[model samples]
Target: MLRHEFQPGRLVAGLVFAAAGTVYAGDAAGLWDTPWFVIVPLVVGGLCLAGATATVTRGIRRRSGKKRLGRSTLDG
Candidate 1:
């Protein structure tokens, strides 16, 4: 039913970057002023968060995979 694996970490990272782009776009459109230094921390913090999320997700998937395999073996 799925074409590819869904990665939440990538999704979060993409949303963060999209937010940063939107901020700049708004500033360009005269909606608000964004400080030049704002993107630095935003991107860095987002990347860190994404990395952590990826780690957690990978751990979860691995554990679930092992459990599923174990159950299938027992059932068979």
Candidate 2:
């Protein structure tokens, strides 16, 4: 059986979500201080931005390659 490859970007996003949830849980448990609470939102927002950028970049690259191939075939 072929194993699926692991994606670091996806892993990072998952970890960020987990961490944010843990932080929220800690706050509910009265273990998290207000000063440290800002980190959770920042981490989650950063992960979202990174993931979106990665996806858009990959899509643009793929489309550019396809267009290049089409243009080359047309010129030939």
Choose the strongest candidate by lDDT.
Answer: 1
TM-score per candidate: 0.91, 0.50
Clashing pairs in 1: none
Tens digit per residue, CA lDDT, model 1, 1-76:
7699989999989999999999999999999999999999999999999999999999999999999999999999
Off by over 4 Å in 2: 1-34
Please give the range of 10 consecutive residues that has the lowest summed lDDT in model 2.
5-14
Badly placed stretches (over 4 Å) of model 1 are none
lDDT of each: 0.96, 0.77
Pairs of residues at least 3 apart in sequence or in different chains that clash in candidate 2: none
Candidate 2 global CA lDDT score: 0.77
* lDDT, residue 59, model 2: 80
